[model samples]
Every structure is written in structure tokens, then in C-alpha cells.
Target: MKFSYKAIDDVGTVVAGTLEAENREAVYLALAERGLLPTEVASGESFLRGYLQRLELALERIRPVDLIFFTKQFRTLFKAGIAVVEALRILEFQTQNGKLKRVVAQMGEEISAGGSLGDAFASHPSVFSPLYISMIRAGEASGSLAGVLERLVYIMDHEHRIKARINSAMQYPKIVVGALVAAFLFLLSFVVPAFASIFAGANLTLPLPTRMAMALHAILLQWWMVSLPLILLLLAGVYWYQQTPAGRLRRDRLFLALPIMGPVFCKAAMSRFASIFAILQMSGIGVLDSMRIISDSIGNSAISHEFDKIGDKLREGRGISDPLRSAKYFTPMVINMVAVGEESGRLEEMLQDISDHYDDEVEYEVGRMTELLGPLLIVALAAVVGFFALAIFMPMWDMVQTVG
Candidate 1:
């Protein structure tokens, strides 16, 4: 049966939402399953009409930085001895994003109604990651939600720093490459045509490069209608391909194999895994569960596949280090560190150390990529311009020398 329900939040605030169930008792069980206490449940098609309306909230995406802020704010509020419901209410009222505010209020209602905070957050997977939900569950089970929040805040802030650094490094090269392509196209399409006409009027014997450039300019000027549509179609096809599962897998494979940048992504993925694994371990989650979470946290299917293999090996009773060593992407140093951690029963600490080390490695690689790409782009730009100049100016120089 479909039911329209009214529930109370963690902060004693009333929340009205809808649910699908077998009966009124099932509705209550479902609510309780989510850590909610239903204040009112009404059956029939009356509530189902509003289901679509409730389904479409503000639709705002929750950003990483916003999540970090939320975690820190919650930690502070919880540490101050404020109840979860009240804390959520305050955040819901104060939050700038309409979507997040509504979500926070919904979670507050669920939690207040006796639902777990983790389950409430889990309901909105688009806004909350599996790692975030898992950590919350671990914290709730261990009765150390505040401590988990603190660690989550730290991990998020650390991730933010690393991401910002990589983005900053990548942004400059992207801009340079884009600019180069634009200038090259502009020169070839417009500027070359004008020069070609001048050379044609003079009836000068053009060099092979100038002849080829003029020929290309002629084709662009005459048949751009066909070329433009063809180009657009090709680009659209490529984009559509990229959006497909097979295409995404191929793209990621190429990205991971790319020189300089590939290693950085690999290191960053491993670092995220280690960071999450450490948090899960410290929060008292088991090794098997921790490894499962690590797969989702990494964000790369190639790496996730390797983790899945490792997971299967563990399920077969093999230890962590041995399974991990088989992953081609795992550096020898990381494998050694995990082996050491296993021996000392300090795997969490070792994982944390590995995370920190990779963070440094990612930073160093970003800097190196920047240093290497700058000169390479400059040389490329110079080469292209030099070629155009030789093509356009070579005939002129020959004529002037002949006149002298």
C-alpha cells in the first residue's frame, strides 16, 4: 500500500513525506528501518499523487567543498553537546543551497523519528557517497559519531587541497592548448587566405609549403559547409562514445597510461583508498568491509577492478598484502608498507602514512607536469608559428634576393 506519512526529525521538528509499503505496519517498519518514527500514516492513492512532486526536490548538486563545510560544522555542533536533530535543524535553516536545506531537514526528521543518520544520508546517494554513508554507520555502531565526523572533516579537507592543486596545475596547460588551437585555426582559415590572394595576384612561384597552405585554405573557403557539419558530427559521435560504459573504460585506460599525468591519477586514487581504509579501520570497521568500501572510494574503474580481484582473493582466505601485491598499479613501496603494517598490527597507521606519502607524490607530480608542459607547449606554439612564417615569407625572401 502507498502511505502518506508525517514524522518527527532529530530536532523535534515535524516532517511530512510519502512511502510505499504492504500496509500501515510495514510503513512503520520501513520508517523504523531508516531510523524514523512516523507520527501519522494514511493509506490509499491520495498520497501517491504527490509522489512525483516530492521526488523532484530543488535538484542542486552537493559539492565536495560544501560537504567538507557540512562535516566540520556538524562536528563542531555535535562536540558542543547539541543533539543531532537540533544540529541538522540549524544547518537546514542556515544552509544557502535550497536542495541541501531540504535534504538536511528530511534527514533530521528521519533521525528524530529513530532512523540512523547514515540511512537518512544514504537515501540521497546523489548527494552522499558510499564512503560517507559507511563511515557514518561505523561511527553510529561504535557510538563515536563525533570522532568520526572529525576524521571525515580532516580527510575531506585534505582531499580538497590535493584536488585544488591538481586542478590548478592542469588548468594552465588546458588554457594554453586551447589558445594554441584557436590561433592556429584563425591563422589557417582567415589570415592564410588573404596572404594566398596577394601571392596569387603577384603570380609568384609559391614554395611547396605555401602551395599546400593555400590549397588547404581554398578547400576550407569553398567546402566549409560539408567540413563543418562533418566535424561537428564526428565530435558528437566521440562525445557519445565517451559517455558509454565501454568508451569510459577505454578513456580511463588511456588516461592511466598517459605519461606524467597517469601516475598522478594512479597515486591519487591509491591515496584516497588508503585514506578511507584508515578511517574505516579506526572507526572499528572490519578488514573485509573496509576493502569493499575502498573500491567505491577510488573513483577509477580500472583500480576498482584490481580491488575487486584483491577482494575475491581475501574472500578465498588470502591476506591483504599478497592480494594487493598482485595489483600492477600498487607501487612496491606501498605493498611493503602494508606488509609491515600487517606484521605490527598497525595497518591503519601504515595506510595513513601511505596516504600522506602519495599526497606528497601527487603534489610533486603536479609541479613536475607543470614544469615539463610549459616548455613543451611553448616549443609547440613556436614550431607552428615558425612553419606558417616559413610558408608565407619564404617566397618573398627569394623574390627580394633575386631583385638585389
Candidate 2:
């Protein structure tokens, strides 16, 4: 349940805002812990307001870059000795991103209404991840909000650059595949038909490749109405299957087991896990909490499920390295590196090093993938076009020789 409450702070200032909790008692305890005296607490606003707010949040095009800028600005303002409320007000008015501006305004309102900074951020779960909220909560408790937000800004910016690098590497292959498909379709629809008609006039024994090519074109032309829908239906079925839990697990597992791309993805996932783990730990969050938060952030269900297993063992009081070793997703080097970190009492620093190392690995693998896949894609395209050209022209040359 969410509650709207009016409370008095230690300074005799009144504040009121909304927050979610399991029950009213939970809400009261949360406020009381923050040194606020609740005067009135009630269930949150009308369903219509909730619906409109959700609609706005859904339509918001807020990006990671936006959040990075928000965090950096908030940190700078807070560090400059500006009051939290005043800093938030400045942020609310000045942010160029309309979505983030509104979110900042909402935070300002929550601050004015006596909501704790952590809970205020938590309320906008879509814009702020659990990791982000948890770190903020830690910072609030430790009186290090500015440092925490600065660290978050770094993590968010690093993640964006990593994704950009991976996407950049993939662009060439996408263009090549699109061009290949378009060229094949053009030949089948335009160029192949003319040769096919000429062949029909000759009525002679065509070479095997020519016959096969013409036969394929015939099948496509004759049953295109059926084939097109069937192709779409197959694609749709695969998409639906991949969405299911079991199907998703199996499919993602297959992705990690693939030849070239698999290693790249695995490295990226490991880097992400280490990066989040490091940043959260550096922000003074507990190891178990960091793992739980990282499991949600990694975006790979199979790898995430493995992290869940590690969390379960952490609850059992086992060290991180043991559970990680048992998981297939963790490379032996990672397990050893984690074990070293645990022994050294500088696990956060160690994890940050590991993350940096894998970021380089991801960069190297992406470069290698682009270098290898680009030439392979071009050669494959050439071979296909060559086959089509030879198939059609062979018959033409034979016919000309006979007439001569």
C-alpha cells in the first residue's frame, strides 16, 4: 500500500508525501526511523491520478544519459552546500529533459511533503532502478548522498558507452544482411524471370544449378501467398516461444553457447556484473544486497538465475566465490579473481579491476568480431551472387554457341 502523510521534522518543519510499504505500520516505522512525527496518514490519491501518472511515466522517453546528467547535477548542487530541497527545485526547473524535469519536480514535492529522499526516489521505480534506490538509501543513512550519486553517474555513463560500443560493432553485419536479402529478392523478382522465360523458349536440358534456381523461383512465385504468411507465422511463433520462461532460458543458454558471439556476450555480461557489484560496494552497500541488485540489472535471465543461486548460498553464510564456481556462467578466472578479492579484504577494488579488464576484453572481442564477420559477410554475399549469375548465364552462352 502507498500512503500520503503529513509529518513534523526535528526542526518543526511540516512535510507530506506519498510512499509505498507493506502496511500503515511499515509506513509509520519508516517515517519514525527518519526522525519524522506523522500527524496524519492515509491511503494515496484517487485511481484516476494514479492512472494518469503511470501513463505519463510510460510515455516518458527518459534515457540513461538523462539520468547521468541528473545525478551529476544533483551531486554538484548538494556538495555545494545547497539545501536538498533547494537543489531539487533548481534541478526541477532547469533540466532540459522534460521527463527528468517532471521527475525532479515530483522529488521536490516529496521533499516538501516530508518524504525521505530514498523513498521519494523509490516511488518512481521505472525511472530509478532498485540498485539506484538502494544506493541512495545507503547514502542517506551514511550522510554521503553526493558521493553516492557521483558514483552512480559514473556507472550509468560507463554502461551507456559499453552498449554503444557493442551496437557500433553490430552495424556492419546488419547492413550486409539487409543488402543481401534485398539483392536476392531483386534477382528473383526481376532478373531471374527474364532468364526463366528465355529458358522456357529453349526447351533444352538446363544445367542442374540453373534448374534448381529456376525451380526455387517457380515455387516462390507459385505459392508466395501461402509462403509469405507461413514465414510470418513461423517468426511470430518463435517470438512467442522466446517470451516464455522455459523457452527464454533455453534460448539464452543457446546464445551463450554460440561460437563467435557467445564469448563476446559472456564477457560483456561478466563485466556488467562486476561493474554493478563494484559500484554498489564502493557506495557502502552490503555484498549480499549488491548481488541481489546486480541480478536484476544484468538483463540475461540465465545468468541472472545463476546469481539468484549465489544469493541463496550467501543467505546460507557461504562466501561469494564458492557459489560462483558452481555456476557454469562464471569463468574459472572470475572465480579465482573473486576468491582473491575476498581474501584481500578489498573486494570492491578487486571487482572494479575485474570489470575494467573485461571491458577491454569486450572491446577486443567486438573488434575481432567486426573484422572477421565483415569479410565473411562480404564473401558469402559474393558467392551467392556468383551462383545466381553463373546459373542464368550458362544457359545463355550455350544457346548462342548452338545458333552460331
Candidate 3:
């Protein structure tokens, strides 16, 4: 069932949203989870609409920049010796993202109720990652929460920049490809059909290219109703499957095996692992715990799953470098650095160096990819345009010659 509720936020402002649950009790629980106090609750008018709204709310994500800003502010406040609850309260007011503000409010409530900072953060696993929680816990135990937060800000900000760079670099290609697809569809559905009618009335012998185009237009007209929904369903199914564990592993593996972009992605993942691992170590987290945290937080499931085995090997009395050497996802340079760092008791420094190296490599590769893909897309666009033009005009030329 669906329930619509008007709830008061942390600041006593009445906010309204929909929730899917069994009863009023469930609605209350759900609202409480979002740091809201229910003032009025009623059954929703439409079950389907409410369900969709609830799903949309569930999928709403807090942006990385918001997270970085939050962490930076908290770090500054905490460094000045502010109390945890007070800092969280300040953040709740300062934060712009509605969901993040509510999360901050809940964290403040938890802290005020005598919960540990790590526990408060752990309660919202969807917002804060395991690595973040682990580092927070380590910081609290060591009374260095400010430093931990500072490192977190750096990590989050750096990751955000890398992602932004990749996205910006690919924007042109995405636009071009989308336009090409749109043009193809429009011509096939509208232009080709009109031309097909003209050719039919002329009763002229059509060239092979014209025949092929007509055949495609015929198939499109006949099966569009069925094909459109089937294609959408197929895409949705593939997306859903990609979210599963096994399917994610296959997806990541495929991502890393792509020709040009694979190296860029692989380097970026390595950079992330190195940087996070170094920070965790410098934060005084144990190696095994750090490995586990990294495994859980790493974006690529295939690499994370492989990295998880290192912890098992560590438990069996193996060193970090030894296990990493067996992990195929890691490059030889990374393995060697790990070995050297382990030998010299400078693993943190070594990991930081690896991160820096990969960061440069990823940037360079992304630039090169942009250069390569521009020409490739232009050539592809020209080929498609040429094919369509030839298909439409070849028979027109034949008819003109016959008349002459």
C-alpha cells in the first residue's frame, strides 16, 4: 500500500512526500528513518503513482561535490574543537541537498543520544561508504577525526574531478552519436516511407541500395508497435541484470577489456585503490580491515572481488604484496611498488606514488581518447550520411536517364 504524509523536518518546516508501506506504523518508521516527524498521514490516491514516486525518491543520490563540501565544513568546524552534535547541527542548516540535510539531522540526533560518530554514519550506509565509516571510527578512536575528515575531502574531491573530466571529454561524442541515431530513426520512419511511395508509383526498376532501404522501412512499419516495447523491455532487463553481483562482475570485466577506454578505466580504478589504501593506512587502520573496507567501497566489482582475496591470504599469514602479485587486475608497477614499500616500511608513500602515477596516466589517456574518437565519429557519421543519400537518390537518377 501507499501512504502520503505531511511531515515536519528538522527545522519544523512541514514537508510532504509519499511512502510505500503496510500501515501507519510503517509510515512512521520510514519517516523517522529520514529524520522527519509525521504530522498527518493518509492513504495515497493512486497506488501505481505512489509506488513510482517512492522509487524515484529511493533512487535520488547525493552528489559527490555536496559530500565533499559537507566533509570540508565538518573538518573545519571539528578542527576548531566543536562538539560532534553541534557540528552536525550546523551542517544540517548549511547543507543544500534535502536528503543530505535530513541525514545530517539524523546523525546529529544519534550523536546527541550518545551514539558514536561511526555508528551514526553507519546507520546510513547508502549515504556513507564502508570506507568512510571505517575511517571515521579509526579517527574517533585515535582522537583525530579532523584529520580523517580532511583526507576524506581530498579523496572525494579528487574522485569527483576525475569523473567530471571523463564526462566532459566524452560529451561531444555522446552528442554526436545521439544525433546520428536520431537522424537515422527519423529518416527510416518518415523520409524513407515517402520516398518508397514515390518509387512505387513510378514503377521504375530500383537499385539494390534503394531496395534494401525500402525493405527496412517495410519491416519498421510492420513491427514498430511490437519492436519498440520489446526493445525498451530488453534494455530495462539488461540494466536490472547489471545491478546483480554476477552480472556486475561480467560487466566490469567487459569494461576493462574494451580497446581504447579500458586502459583509462583501469588506471582510474588503480588510482582510487592506491589513494584510498594509502589514506586508510595513514589513518591508522589495520591492513586487513583496510583491505576489507577497500573491497566493499571500490566501484568495480570485479577488481573489488579479486582484491577481497588478498584479505584471506593475509589471514593465512601472507604479506600484502604477495597476494597483490597474484591479482591480475593490478599492474606490475603497482605490485613492485607494494613489494618495495613493504620492504622499506614506506607502504603509504609507495601507494601515494602509485596513485599519482595513475592519475597522470588517466588524464593523458582521456585526452588521447578524445582526439581519437572525434575523427572516428566524424568518419562514421559521413559513412551513414553517404549510405542514406545513395539509397534515396540512385533510383531518381535512373528514372531521369530513362526519360531522357
Candidate 4:
């Protein structure tokens, strides 16, 4: 546990700080050992604990892999007949990440102090998500926490795979763009200037393209003086805009509505929703609650808003397929499958199929798009370079012919 402490030293100097320790008594003893008299020692169970809890909660938002590993390890240990508190204690020592280690230690202490596994995880809500907590609660209620942990691992692994594919798909384009930008800067700053110097002394009347190239080169040289502030202002504007809910919504909508990427984005979002819903269903969470949790997990405001309406419809006892069909973001085929699932009482199975199907579709589309982008970008670069070369040399060719 962590505590905030204020202590007076032997020479009457006061010191205040926070530290992680075993308990309040241990904290006081440690201070006394340092020749300090504790004037005020705030326990980890106080307001400071609440603050740490909030920080832990935020960290949890980004640590899906960590959660998966923890769950998987805990389950493995549990199945081997290791006690829960003992397993957590071993995990605390085994973890290399300081924050995770600290968290595991805290959990171990909590459980050892008679807190239930779910309650221990609940205390660090930042690390364990609603889906995680819900599934654990179900497992506890059903007396199958080990099984639930295994399922959680599978779900997390699936999510990781999807994220990896997206990253892989984007990597080529990112590299291409980065290379293009570097090459452009090199030419404008060095190559173009060298050519410009040579042409300057040639006393030739340059052609239109050559003149345009020279103008561009000059502007680039001068641009930083104007461009720097403009860029900073643009960044500031973007930051300010994103800070506003409306602005963020508008930005998200724009991203989803992009011509080439909209379909891919929508498919990815749908895939996530389907996969999360399937996991929730399998974990014994109800349909409406599952939808709400899945919506929160999707991470897009526009899609989440539509999901909210779907939840409302579900609350009114309408079929899941009805609101999903009305949303129009999902394809007709998807809606049909969902309808079939609803009718067959196998929504989880159908959702898993949907997730698998779209994941493949997304992967294929991303690969195709990446393959198409490479040649298109290369052609554009060649055209720009060719135009500049022809423009500049044409004047030189005319000059050489006259001299000959």
C-alpha cells in the first residue's frame, strides 16, 4: 500500500512525501527509524488512495495485454492448485514492470486480507475493464474463474491480432510517405539549389517549368520563416478543436466518412463490436449490458452514439437485429446473420463468425490498398521529377544547339 507522510526530523525539519509500504504501522516505524517523528501519516486507504486508484484506472485503459497476461497466469496457477493470494504474490515478484508489480502486490495484499478476487480486481478498475470485471464476477458466481480467465486470454489474443493486422497494413504507407517527404526535402534544400546555382551562371532564359521549379525552390528556402508559425498555429487549432466534444465528434465523423478509408474503418469498428459482444455473451453477461459494454469498448463517438440508441431499443424489448438493421452502418449480410442468430438463440456464435469474416475482409482490403498505393506514389514521384528535369534541360538543350 501507498501512503502520504509528513514527519519531523530530529533537528526539527519537516518532510512530506509519498511512499509505498506494507501498512500504516510500517510507515510510522520506517519514519521513526529515520529519526523522524510522524506528525501526520495518511494511509493508503485514504484520499491519496483514491487518487492512486484513479491513476491506476487510467493506466488500465491502455494495458489490455497486461490484463490478459495477468489473467492467464492467475488461471494457470489456480488450476495447478495454487492459492489465489499465493499466486498473486508470486505474480507480484515475477512481474518486471514496476507499476504492474506494485498493482499485483496491492492485489495480493488485498486478497490475503480477505478481499474476494473480483473485489481485489475491482479496486484497480483502471487496470481491469468492465468486461474483465463482469466476466470475473460471472466466473465467481458460476464457480469457474479459471475457465473465465482462459476465455479472457482468447478474447485479448483476438483483439491483439486485429490491432496487429491494422498496424501491418498501415506500416507500408507510413514508410512510403515518410520516405517521400525526406526525398522532397533533400531535393528542395540541396539538389535543387545546386542546379539553381549552375543555371544562374549559364545566362540562359529558362523555360516555364524551370522557372517554376526555381520559384518553388526559393519559396522553400524562405518558407520556414513563415511556415513555422503557421504550422504551430495549425497544431494549436487542432489541439483546441479536439478539446471540444463537438469538434472531436466532427473529426471522428470525418474520419469515418473518408472516401477510400470509410469502408475499412466501418468494417473494423463493426468487427470490434461483434467480437466484444460475442465475448460478453460467452462470459454470461446479458445482451443489453453486453451492448453497452461493447459500445464503450469500440472507442468511436459516432459508432458509440448509434450503439446507445440500439441499447435503448433493446431496453424497450426490441430485437437486437432491428436496431442494428436501422443503424445502416452494418451491411445487409451482417444484419441477416444477426437476425438468424437472434432467432436461433446463438447470437454469440453468429457474432464470432461475423468477426472472423470481416477480419479477413479488412486484411485483404488493407493489403490491396497498400499494394495499389506503392506504384501510385512511385508514379507521382517520377512524374514530378521528370517534369522538373525536362523543364530545366530544355533551355540548356536550346542553348547548346545555338552554340553548336
Better of 2 and 3 by TM-score: 3
Task: Please tell me which predicted candidate would have the highest TM-score against the true structure.
Answer: 3
lDDT of 4 by residue, 200-302 (tens): 8878788888788788888877887898789999999999998787887787788789776667778888888888888778777888888778776786778
* Candidate 1 residue runs with Cα over 4 Å from true position: 1-60, 402-404
- The sequence of per-residue lDDT tens digits that candidate 2 reaches over residues 214-326 is 88899989999999999999999999999998888888889889888888889999999988998887888887888889988887888988988899999999998999989
- Deviation in angstroms for 102 in model 2? 2.8
Off by over 4 Å in 2: 1-60
Lowest lDDT block of 10, candidate 4: 57-66
Winner by lDDT between candidate 2 and candidate 1: 2
Query: What is the C-alpha local distance difference test score of candidate 2?
Result: 0.88
lDDT of 3 by residue, 233-310 (tens): 999999999989999999999999988888888899999999999999999999999889889877888899987889
* Best of the candidates, lDDT: 3
Candidate 3: deviation at residue 49, Å? 17
Any idea what lDDT model 3 has?
0.89
Using all chains and alpha carbons, the TM-scores for the candidates as numbered come to 0.82, 0.82, 0.86, 0.80
lDDT of 3 at 375: 92
C-alpha RMSD of candidate 4: 7.5
Q: Each candidate: how many clashes?
A: 13, 3, 0, 3
